[model samples]
Target: MNYIIIKDSQQLTEVCQKARLADVVMLDTEFVRTRTYHPQLGLIQLYDGEQLVLIDPLEIDDMQAFSELLSDTSVTKVLHACGEDLEVFQHAFGCTPTPMIDTQLMAAFLGYGLSTGFAALVNDYLSVELDKSESRADWLARPLTDKQLDYAAADVFYLLPLYQQLLEQVEVKGWLEAVEQESQLLVEKRLKQVKPEQAYLSVKGAWILKPQQLAILKIIAQWRLLEAQKRDLALNFIVKEANMVEVCRNEMTSLKEMNEAGFDHREIRRHGNTLIEMVKQGQAIAESEWPAKITRLMDNPAYKQLFKLLKDEVKLASESSGLATEFLASKKQLNQFISWVWNKDRNPEQLPDVMQGWRKEIVGEALNKKMS
Candidate 1:
């Protein structure tokens, strides 16, 4: 397989022209992001059927043409486990590829289980084993090794053919539209800014906090996220959630107390004053102004029974249909359904936005039937 390494604007333009002619293209990216809020795009590998191109973003200044090709509605972009890759593209190019297909999703729709890794999927579907030893190679390093180039090239080279096979199977199974809808959500731009006060919801122990403590933690978490973004560093580097929770629970008002709680000393030394101010601001907010408490529906026996019933039904349906139970309806969806059913006054049609298509088909009808 001949692979073309595109390191300049001219090569990018030439490749974009060829890519625009294809009905679909396989897309993949290589990056390093362990330390940062955003991925550092090291190499972009794309296969448009006839040519395999490895784009060196470091050497190229203008990727506008390539970006346009991605956003073109006429062309479809095929990827495997593409959520992070899609996010990387949106961050770098300010656009996402349209009409995308995620082979991982396709595999699940065909009963290959949710969350199948790329190499495993390749082995199962194509009977080809992928060399994954270079998975952690430094993509940003100059003078790419022959083995590293081959590893990157292999990602997209077989994807075109794999996509063709999956497309046919999904169409036969009549779940193509379902997978497409899910892919649309994956390709959409992630929120650039989230309210600092709402950040605590992502923390694992957030539910353990009282409303007042939660409000304080929310403010601090939000501040930490902003700081991380400003510094282009990971959130934990700015402040870990465990320490934030400890600070809020203990009501640490002074730098001395904050330091003793195992919080990063440097973070305390640098942002302690501002953190104290935010905590005070959070405390000043009225009780009603605090974020609403997350109510767990499973705490009620009636709802728990309903949830179990839904889970059993989903499992039975998955077995009969040869699809993963998770593909039909997730645990979160089941809980949401129970809550909707419990609230008699709430309209049944207004289920969570995430409840759609095959999920709606499998679970929605049963829910409506049970409620009636």
Candidate 2:
């Protein structure tokens, strides 16, 4: 396959102009995330119907033209499993490609199963074998091997054809709107980083912490997030979660107990004072200000029956709709729905995804009847 390697601003501009004229553009990205809070974009692969090109982001001085092309509303951007790629674009250009459709999302709507790999989708649709040997290649290295370039090229080469078939199936099933809504929601969520105050919820084993402990974790998590972004270091490199949890659990106040709190002396000299102050502040929090306990309906035997009913509804709905079980109604969404129904104190007006949109048409009403 013939592919152009674009290493300069002039070539990128020319490609963007050509891309603007095309009806659809297929895109993929290669990046490294081992060291930094944000992915370091190494390469970008683009296919505009007739042309296949690899643009080296590390070589290009300015990416404004390419970024503008991505933000273009006129042309549709087709990608497969695009969550991380979208994140790369957001970080690189400060804008996300729009009017986007993910082949993976369409495949699920067409009943191929959710979370299908890009290679599997291509092989299933096009009868082409994709070489993933270079899938873990060091894209940031100065000289990329021919095999590596071939691997990158293959990602977008078959996407256009796959998009066409997927599009037809989605249109036939009358699910184009749902696919678009889900894809758009994903893009929006990726673009909007979670707030620092809400970051603690993302910490592993966070739900195990008491309200006061959670308060401390939240402060430390927020500080760690900001520091990671500033220093371009991974969160674990800054402070391990287990250690942070330990400090929170014991309410460590001084650097004297640094080792006992599960943090090393090096970590202590760097962030001990600030972390201790956050602990003190968290310790001083009023009882009313502490976070509410997270209660699960699954713990109750009475609610267990209700949970089984909801699960059965999801299984039946999945069979009826020809959608994957998880796609139809994830366990988390089902739990939320159950909570809404069983707990009168929970908001009925606030429906989970399983209870809204196309899902409402799938199993929501039936589940609501069961509750009634």
Candidate 3:
């Protein structure tokens, strides 16, 4: 359990140089994002099969060497359930790790179930129980205890061995390419910019709103997201999402009106007037300029039958492909595929979650044939 804390540029350069020559490298990050739009990087765990170290993000001045090593593509990067870590790396180094493989996906391919926790994977595969005492430690705090550092070191230390085992089994299933593609999409998904204008689509009650009300919701939602970004605050901290739906639906014109409607007082007081203006602006738009009403997929008259048919097709594909139903296609992906096919707005570039790359080849073709 020995680890070097790379606090200086000289040490980072040395390890990264060696890491560049490595065939495999495992990476993990510790970050805090309780209040902000971006996760605050605390420490980075890196292991290139030989050199295991913790990169002290707080103490280092230049991270260019480590950043370059991330995108080098020659070395395969391994991580367990790496979605958030990808975000941390992207924000810090301006790129997601290249040639990356998510061992979680590897587990799924090997029938270990989807979304397996790191410690569980380690315990089951490597037969080593991970300490969970520091699971919720404030990684951003300085002078991290020996326990904390050991915990962080353990994150990357066992990843190489676990990945090696997973890779061998996944390759036997001929799913190594599939897992790699899935990992790429996972990174790409996080990298996709959130357009404020399109923000209302994800609101829970948005489908009930009329086109014009949706216009108002769109405006205010955009404002709220932009404000959150500007302030580096969480979106709900600026204006609760429910309030956005409510204000747009009820046509409130002032903070006082918002308060009367039982919206969050602090939010109404803070952005009431600004929100009022956004509503007025939305109302000013021509009727023809409003966005189309979102069609609730479940409400379609043929929805029950269509969805069941899709699921049945997925079940058949699962049996044939020797992939589990859960891993072959989740309900979310099934819904996404139906939406993409029925929505009329979907295009190839905006591919559905389960329809991208290897997924399209394995199960997507059968699903399409069933629906086509």
Identify the leading candidate in terms of TM-score: 3
Q: How much is the lDDT of residue 314 in candidate 3?
A: 78
Per-model CA lDDT versus the true structure: 0.82, 0.86, 0.87
Stretches of candidate 3 off by over 4 Å are 345-355
TM-score for each of the candidates: 0.92, 0.91, 0.95
* Per-residue C-alpha lDDT of model 3 across residues 1-372, encoded as one tens digit per residue: 788999999899999999999998999998999988878899999999889999999999999999999999999999888888888898888998998999998888877778779999999989999997897899989899999999999999999889988888888878887888788878877788878889888888998899999999988888888888889898889888888888888888877778888887777778889989989999999999899998888999998999899888878878777778888889888888888888745578767866777777778888887777
Q: Model 2 over residues 122-223: C-alpha lDDT tens digits?
A: 899899988888878788998999999989998988888989988998999999999998788678767778788887877877767799888888889999
* lDDT score for candidate 2 against the true structure: 0.86
Instruction: Report lDDT (Cα) of residue 190, candidate 2.
Output: 70
| Residue 102 lDDT, candidate 2, scale 0-100 | 87
Query: What is the per-residue lDDT of model 1 for residues 1-372, given as tens digits with 9 covering 90 to 100?
Result: 799999889889999999999999999999999989888899999999998999999999999988999899899999998878877898899887787889999988888878998888788779999999998999999998999999999999888778888889999999899889878755652434567657788786777778888889888888888888789998888877787887777767899988777677788987788878878888998998888765566567677677677778778778777888776777876766666667634464766532455666666676656655
Give the poorly placed runs of model 1, Cα more than 4 Å off.
188-193, 339-350
In candidate 1, how many Å is residue 170 off?
1.6
